[model samples]
Target: MSIQSGQSAIEILGPEQPESAAILSAQALQLVEELAERFNVRRDELLQLRLEKQAQIDNGKLPDFLPETASIRNSDWQILGIPADLQDRRVEITGPVERKMVINALNADVKVFMADFEDSLAPAWDKVVQGQANLRDAIRREIDFTHPTTGKSYALRPDPAVLIARVRGLHLDEVHLHWQGRPIAGALVDFGLYFFHNYQQLLDNGSGPYFYVPKLQSHLEARWWAEVFAYTEERFGLQPGTIKATCLIETLPAVFEMDEILYELRNNIVGLNCGRWDYIFSYIKTLRNHSDRVLPDRQAVTMEKPFLNAYSRLLIRTCHRRGALAMGGMAAFIPAKDPAKQEWVLNKVHADKELEAKNGHDGTWVAHPGLADTAMAVMDQYIGELPNQMAISRDSDAPISAQELLEPCQGEATEAGMRANIRIAVQYIEAWISGNGCVPIYGLMEDAATAEISRASIWQWIKHGTHLDNGQLVTVQLFEKMLLEELVTVREELGEARYENGRFGEASELFRSLTSAKELTDFLTLPGYQILTQKTVA
Candidate 1:
């Protein structure tokens, strides 16, 4: 492998000691530099294209199936055959790339552990670099964690789940890495470093450098990743198509182009995940101009809703048609300590997974290790003795339309729902800003995407002048009043002392700024990243 660019040195602007020593070796940095030199330009161009597309949406051009990609959509094509290690993903567990969580998740009874470097992770410099070190140790089964005070130790079991790393989206930039004075794309930094260090080792262990690509907006973005995989294979002297990716159909534009996306990454992508939370956020942002698109309560927008029902069926049909796995979204519920509540949540999870399995999802996502057994049980029942449900096809009598996918829920919006949204936004953001991206709140594991949709729903409600079922108008004044009231509720919930020191004020203000701005922010994390980095530098 040779560097095509006329550069010999790679500059890492971040710290160079300790944790960085393990993952950012000279060879690994070379791979990252090569990836940046080759793909970073195209990444920037694609992000700009996203901005242009959003402008068109703002100008009343609603998102729909692309006419230009009609040939790709209508054509007969399938992605490369499913890789051996990824063929039976009955239940997949996901969490941030943290050490203790890494050891526990891998040991859980699941087929795959998607070590997320994206929404589930807070991208502080120390955390980001340390996460890479953790993943490297995990892949080698050399990971162990000791409780600082309790003196308990945690380690990987004899056999662990297959690891699939999810990198940051294209829009984020890793400021600690620079190429010719420009920040390197965070996606490249995460994917390149991980693959550079582990691809060969994984192959030696009968697996490959698998990934869960997040927040992709279109087929072109999928094509970009396909090219990246091709280039990486060449750079590392590996067989073509050794890397397998699962693109998250999280964005509205992506939902319309699922078939085209799989066609673009036919050589590298093996599955498609229904990123439900981010999908809702994308729905609100995409149709923010239309008053009818204002969503009801967040809780009311479940998988059983019409839009989601169509999305699930359509996803299953699209993936099976192309010989790819249709992975389900996260069931964020965690078992509560209260016995009655625990049973209720577990039943909910079981029902959720049952629906997916019956609808022919090959696999599903569980946010906690505890839910693995329930999810696996449901999958086992529907997919008994079968590697996957890829053979299943949609019946001729049932067909989904673009309009069904676009329709909003008929559930009523309530004042309690509004308060819950604000409460979650504040609580989740507080946890996020403090460098904890995934928080278990009210028995549910809330991540950045959950918080995003919470705030986006509020914004859409206020903008559309939506009225709650109780006859109160959802005006800016009402929202502000509710915000103040919820702040008090949050303070009381967390206690006065914890509230004072917890950055609740900062979280509240940040949530307000994002949701109340005249123009919607492309991503809540973009500004939230600034706060995290600033706090770390201080």
Candidate 2:
């Protein structure tokens, strides 16, 4: 199928769906094609710069504040004023754009709901188009869902949470949509479709189009987005800053350039979020070649770790000083069924939010609706009736240095941790390839970021030949042994019929290849997308 965009055509490789016409209309395709043609070359350049920077890190140069951007960092500047709907974001819930998940997330008692098309979504072609339709219906108050099995019904409440759409990262490509004989940037397709279809309705309802930009590695990337926003606003004859964005400071190099990033998008950005899970993954990937910087078990690297704590504190300081909201990280724990276990989960969430609140964060993210109240209560206690804690600049605190932000966490990898990593990565990858992304596993919400950490940590450990706490050395042979044992354990946990029906074989093979490769794979999704596309074709 092909759609005309001016004189050009966008070739659609995926099977057509009922919502395809409405979401992928000629006008929307035009916007996507224009954005891709104008900005994709710069996106390619920035991605190449990432590899160059990684080469420097591999050669022993640690990341630090840029000397060139010192003027912007030292000079006083502020992001444009945040809109009223986004002011009281004490608690925000996030999920994929599946129909039921969309309805439930928006109706939850939170200040905002980030409808994600990025990490939490599997990005199947049908799901991607259907997700756009779902969000458009939701914005117009026409979306509802009926459970296929339980016969339950769901509809949006009277005043739903504020909606923010997160587009895909620069590194991903929407292979199903080709422009000029190449795949369009996934980021453009997500942003262009959502913005084109819903901006007017959102503005009519007194909320302009809002967004969450993910996986950026530099200020130049931020500038690329800023230019896109400016061009879109001008094209639509809307006011400048009509599209407010909150960028995720998830990459290790981005932490050092927070001020610069905010400055580049100052007119269109409202805040910066601590995308902690991806940040940890970035920590490992950026320092994969540094023997002394090896991290311990994933569980051991908590927010209280010196490097993570320094990152949080510095983000708070920098954002508050520059008049941008400093949002906290995710509370990934899902409530357990058992009463005692549920209490323990809530307590962990409470403690985590308390740390973020005390450190002067204006908001936090929760993966489950069950967690929203707990996160909100903690933020309320610290912020009182205030919309946010922006007034608390943390000016009196000691400056966080590069060494602290890069501090090597002190702990040893355990056999249990390694086993758990193998299990989670395999199971999550299986689910992802099966067209589900947000999954509940072992009482935690597991998404692409956590799965990346799981596999990447093991790769880093094996690459460095580190010793586990059990006095076992990490090697390809040991990893393979554990892989087989873990599969057996998983097979027993899940019955034979279910195991046979699932995609564990493919998942395990992919995981094994990733962890045993000569160098760490940048993202498992890069390879996993191939499997997904092949499965779709078959």
Candidate 3:
């Protein structure tokens, strides 16, 4: 199956399907083409700037608050008033935009559901296009699902949670959709397809075309999105603030420019989210060359760490100062079925959300629907009868210094943690390459962000010749040995037939190459994506 270019510059390399027809219609492709033609060059420039900034960091020029943007930070400006539907996002549940997951997430007891096309999603062509189709049906209230085995059904209940689409970051490309012989930016493809197909429907449903912009490393990247939003709004004859967005302050550099990011998108922006997993991954990647800044085991690097805490506090302070909602990070725990383990999961979630609410955050995120009630209860305890804690201006708190924001966390990297990292990364990459982005491994919902941390931590440890808790130095040979053992263990758990049929062999090779690379790879997905496309095209 194929789509004719139909005189448009964009070409669809992905196989055509009945469901993708409406999503990749000529008009929709036009919007994507125009957006790419207009903004793709700037996107390239900004991504290159990211590399240059990393080089600077590598050369001992650590990130600090920009003096030029100091005036923006010091100014007492508030973003435009958040829309009514966005005002009370006390508990937002996030998942990939699959049909059943979409229905379940919206029907959950949360206030908002972020339909993700970013980290939680592996951008295989069918999934990407079908996700847009699923969202289209969801907005129109025409979506439903039936379990193939039990014939159980799922559908949205009355007054479902508000839906916000999260587009891909700037660093990714939609290899399926090419304009002028090069792949278009994945963000534009997602934003354009979703906005073109659903904006009017969403508006008719009394909700704006909302978004969650991810992995923005600087205010300039934020500015690019602002311009795109403005162009889209005007092109469609919509009002200036008709398209609302919540930027994820998920990168190390973005923590410093929260104020400036909000300032740039003030007209259309409503809040900022603590995308903690990616932020942790960003912390390691951004400072990979700084041996002193090496992070401990992923489990040990909780939000309680001083640097992470400072980041949350600063985001809350910055967003609230400007009348924007200060959203919290994700509680990625998937509630265990075992009563005792579920108790522990809920307890952990409660403490995490409690910290966020007490820190003046207006809302928080949970990965699973089962954890919503626990998170909601905590938010209610702290912010009862309030739509949001925007009024909680933390002016009295001590100013968080740049030093605190960049402070190295202290903990041990144990052999157990190393083995866990190896297992998680290998299994996640296997799942990702097989077109499943979200997987439950060892009782937790693992996504691309967590997998990233796992692999990046290993790379950073090996790069710096760090020692494990047992006093064994981290070396490529050590990692290989553990990886081989973990694969055998995984095979035993998965059974021989399943292991042989699975992409564990490919996944293991990729993970090994990533950890053994001379330079830290930008994203595991980039390499994983190449594999996915190769398989899809074959």
Q: Which candidate wins on lDDT?
A: 3
lDDT of 1 by residue, 373-471 (tens): 999999999989989998887755276777888996788889999999999999999888889999988778999999998999888888888989999
lDDT (Cα, 0-100) at 71 in candidate 1: 91
Instruction: For residues 1-538, write the lDDT of model 2, one tens digit per residue.
Output: 4444444477777877899888888888889888988988888898999999999999999999999999998998799889999888999999999999999999887999999999999999888999999999999999999999999999999899999999999999888888888888899999999999999999999998999999989999999999999999999999999999999999999999999999999999999999999999999999999999999999999999999999999999999998889999999999899999999999999999999999999999999999899999999999999999999998999988899989998998999999999999988999999889899989999999999999999999999999999899999999999999999988998889989999999999999999999989888888888887774431
What lDDT does model 1 reach? Answer: 0.88
lDDT of 3 by residue, 217-240 (tens): 999999999999999999999999
Using all chains and alpha carbons, the TM-scores for the candidates as numbered come to 0.97, 0.99, 0.99
User: Would you list the C-alpha lDDT of every candidate in the order shown?
Assistant: 0.88, 0.93, 0.94
RMSD of 3: 1.0
| Candidate 3, lDDT over the whole model | 0.94
Error of 3 at 276 (Å): 0.7
**Candidate 1, which segments miss by more than 4 Å at Cα?**
1-9, 395-397, 535-538
| Per-candidate alpha-carbon RMSD to the true structure | 2.7, 1.2, 1.0
